[model samples]
Structure formats: C-alpha cells, structure tokens
Target: MEIIFLDQNKWIELAQVHSGRIKGGPIAQLFPRLVAAVREGRVLFPLSVANIMETAKRNDDVSRRLIAETQAMLSLGYVHRSRAARIEVELRAAIQRRFGIEPERMPTHWAIAPGFMQAFEPMDELMASPGELARVRRMTSLVDPAALYLNYMVTQDDTRRREANAKLSEGLSALVAQIEGRRARFASESLDMRRRIYAAQSWVDHLDVLNRIVAALGYSFDDLSALGDSTMRALLEDVPTMNVEVEMATRLEAKTGTLSANDVLDMQSFYTAIPYSDRVIAEKAAISHAQQAKLDSKYGVILSRSLEDLSGHYVS
Candidate 1:
C-alpha cells in the first residue's frame, strides 16, 4: 500500500470535526476520504513516535480517540538505530559537498544502548561556543532532537536536566515567536503578496542545489520525482539515506532561522516519514523545510498540504 503521513494538525482537524467542535469545513470533507482510503488499503497512515507525543499532549477524548484510532489502523514506526547511522554518514558527506564544512571526525550515531536509540534533540547553537557547536551539530544531526532532549531531561543528573530544559525552553520560545510572527505577517493582505514572492524565490535558489546533489547520487532528476510507492521504496532500500530534514534545518538555518523544541519535533515527524512513507502531508512550515532541503525531489516523495491534492496525486 502507498504510505501517507499526516501532520499532527491534520489529525487534530479530523478529530475536532468528528467531535463536532467545527462543522462542515474542508477537513470534514477530507477526513472521510482519508478514512476510506486507509480502510480500503489504498494507502497506509503510519504513525510515528512524534504523533504519539503530540496527541498525548492533549487530554481530551477527541485527541485520545484519534491516537487510538491511528494506532489501530497502523503501527507506529521510528528511526531505527541502524538507519540513523546510515543517515549520519550520508549527512556528513552532503554537508561537506554543499557547504564545505568538514568535521574532524565522523559523528557517531547515538545508539550506544538499546534505550538511547532513535532519540535526538535539535542542536541549540545559542547554548554552545563555536567549538562546542561543531560537536553538538554532529551529534544532533544523527538523532531526533525531541528524543535526545527528552532522554536528557529524564535520565540525566538533576543539574544537567535543569540546564538542558532552560536551553530548550528559551529556544522553543524564540522559534514559536518566529513562526507566529511570520504567520501574522503573512496573514496581512498587504504583506501576503511580498511574502509569496520571497518564498518562491527561496525555493528556486535552494532547489537548484538540491537537484544537483540528487543527480550526483545517480538518481535521474525526472525519474526521481515521478517514482511510485513500490519503485520509491525499492530505490530507498538500495541506497544510503541522509537526514534531509536536519540538512535542511542546517543549511536553511540562516534563512529559515533557529528552531524551537516544537519545531524540531514537527520536523522529526516528517523525517520519520522519509523511510516509512511514500508521501508526507504536512503544513506550510514543514513542507517548506522539506522543499528547502529539497527532500521531496531528492527522495522522490510527494509533500503536500491539501488532502485533496494527495487524493488526486495518489490514485490507486
């Protein structure tokens, strides 16, 4: 079955509509089609650890049912330790090629113990010195920041957890404000036109580099974008995978700016989908990050916001 990964917002939209919190909107129309598609085995809606955490944040019955329903329909998948190691290796090469920044030594995947596997946190440059940032950068690139942060918070000494939490909170606040500010600006009719023009230009510049990298990886540019579920899965199985999300966050750090804890977690959700799903259905911010990283084209995955768009694109 074709895999379709939904962002947390889409799940919440479906849940709220189901509970009659809102009536007769596009989500109402979209939700049923998604359910039918999943039920008929036309697609697979694989949940991730990120989905579980995001849904668990809300205590309402609607959110509870949504989580349970998703779990029932599909098993939750995570970034396996082995896969993460491969991603880290490729990530280093991509960074060197694209940015000319080379690490002194290859970063090791954070899979020392069973429990440490698949855990990661965003590299908070603000909290580190230049030397420290370089090391932290490699470590963060290998694992999910949310997982790493959470593991650090719970398992570390009290003094360390306190420090990490403080940094996490500060980073999250800054990122949240940044996204909110962007939302407010883009919401304005006067600014919307200029915002779209700027965003379009950013995509054009980023995609050129990304497309070149994918081509260097021996994937045909045209064939890569047109891959179907089975073909895409086979291709990924045959190649080394890079953490496109982290690479995007790293490269676009100057353009897209620093990320918050929530932003990192949101990213981890899409990153998890890279290996486990055929397409990633997400919000503008998430989609933009992937596009900026050129992951959609590079990895041959469909990234779209509209459920209708996906429906038309993924007809079985």
Candidate 2:
C-alpha cells in the first residue's frame, strides 16, 4: 500500500493508533516505508527521518526503538566504505574552499548526508592535506562535521572565558586572605599603638582588597563584553557566588562605597528586565527600608510610611 502525507489531524490520529501496536517494530519495517517513499520522490522522507531521530533522543525507549528500526533498514543495503571515504574527501574539499581552512583543524566532527556523499567524489588533488584526513576521521563518528565544528567553536569560547574567571577568582581569594592577615597582625599590637597605627591601615587594607577585586572583575567583564552583550550578560547572571563571599563583599562595599556606578549598570544589564524588574525594584525598596531601620535603631532617626505613600510610587 502506498502511504500518503497525512494532514495534522490525520497524523495525530495515526500517532495515537500506532503508539500501542508498534511498541518495538524491527528497524527495517519503520524506515523502509519512509525510504521507499523518498526513493520514489513522492514525499520528502529525509526530513521526517531527521525529525524522528531528534525526537527519539528525548526519551530512551523511543531512541532505542528508533535505532532498532533504523538498523533493520540499513542491513538491507550494503554500504560501501570506500565510497563513503571518497565522499568525505569531497566534503572536506568543499569545507576548505568555503572556510579557507582544512576541516581536520576544526575540533568537532563534520558529518554529511548519505545521499550527498554518494553523489560526489573527491579528486586526488583535493586529498593532499593532513588536516583534511583528520577531519574525515572525525566526521565518520558524527552526522555532520561542519555543524559539529561550529558547536565546538562556541563551546571552546565559553570554556576559555570560564578559565579566565577561575583565575580571577583565585587572585581575589589570595588578595582577600592577605588583607585579612594584615588586619589580624595589626590588631595584635599594643592597645594604644593599635588605635593609632592600625586605624588608617585597617581601612586602607580593606579598601585596597575591594578595589583589586572590583578591578579584576571589571577586566573579566570587559573581556566577555567584547564577545557580545548577551554572552557577557549570561556569564554575569549565571556566575556562581558563595554566600560568604556575597555577604562579605556586600558589607565591604556598604562601608567603603567602593562599588561604582558602572558596576551597578553592568549588573543591572545582566539580568532579564521583564521578569526581574519588579523583583529587583522590590529588593531595592527592601534595602532602603532596612537602611532606614538601622538608622532609626542606632541614631534615633525615626521614619514613617503610609499606605497612600506606598501606593504613590511606581516600583520602576
């Protein structure tokens, strides 16, 4: 029986019907129908096959079933390794021509469609580069080498940024420790000398440490920012911060007012404005209230607020 492309509703009905009966059909049964449909040029089954493969990955059972079905189909035809290799060479040449670089120099697999590979063969002259050979090897394990190379480049760039941030974190930790150690030593001096000698030294050490951390962070931020605003924003928003570090940094900045306007802008821009706007405004208001409470408790500076006053101001 010839299969036809079903409309959305018919497709949904077919899915419901086949969902139970085809629990684990032989691979040959599933794809041959589709492949035959493609061979006849009646429908575009390649896209359907690709879509099924992607969908299968989301569930193990589906993936296993799909793999079994595909395997059964592939077993029907004898795939020529030499033909595949020649096709790989053709693809490598195409890549080199497009990018001005050999595929093997790329860090990821370059895969091509079986049909495309079978249709083209590489000339011997195009097979001269070692990089091209290496690319062919990598592509053997991948679906598409060019796509894989692009993904690899993105991953490598992120990894480089993460390594830079890690180095900066280590530097900040050492500086913080050094400043704390200096403060402890200065505190151990005689009481009279402690107040006179350590007063300025203590504040200076604390400020210096904060300044260095902020400066290091700024440099890291600048490097990521150069990549793109979105990447920079994601890095800052998703960066892991220890509770102790966050609290300490906040207290230090509160005392020293060392966090500049630029730093605030960097952080504000990093967060998503839509969902975070109200939350951020509320948090800022809470901080203001907390500061007012501290003043009232310590300095007898009582402040009052009414429902009318609260409603009068927009959070933004």
Best by TM-score: 1
TM-score of 2: 0.19
Would you give me the overall lDDT of model 1? 0.52
Compose the digit string of candidate 1's lDDT tens values, residues 37-120.
Answer: 766856656555556555444435445655444433332222223334434444335434433345336433222112222323
Window of ten residues with lowest summed lDDT in model 1? 109-118
Candidates' lDDT values, in order?
A: 0.52, 0.31
Per-residue lDDT for 282 in model 1? 83
Worst window of 10 by summed lDDT in candidate 2 = 270-279
Give TM per candidate.
Answer: 0.48, 0.19
Candidate 2, residue 16: CA error in Å? 39
Q: Candidate 2 regions off by >4 Å?
A: 1-156, 189-312
Task: For each of the candidates, give the backbone clash count.
Answer: 6, 7
lDDT for each residue of candidate 2 in 47-80, tens digit (9 for 90 to 100): 1221222222232444334333332232221111
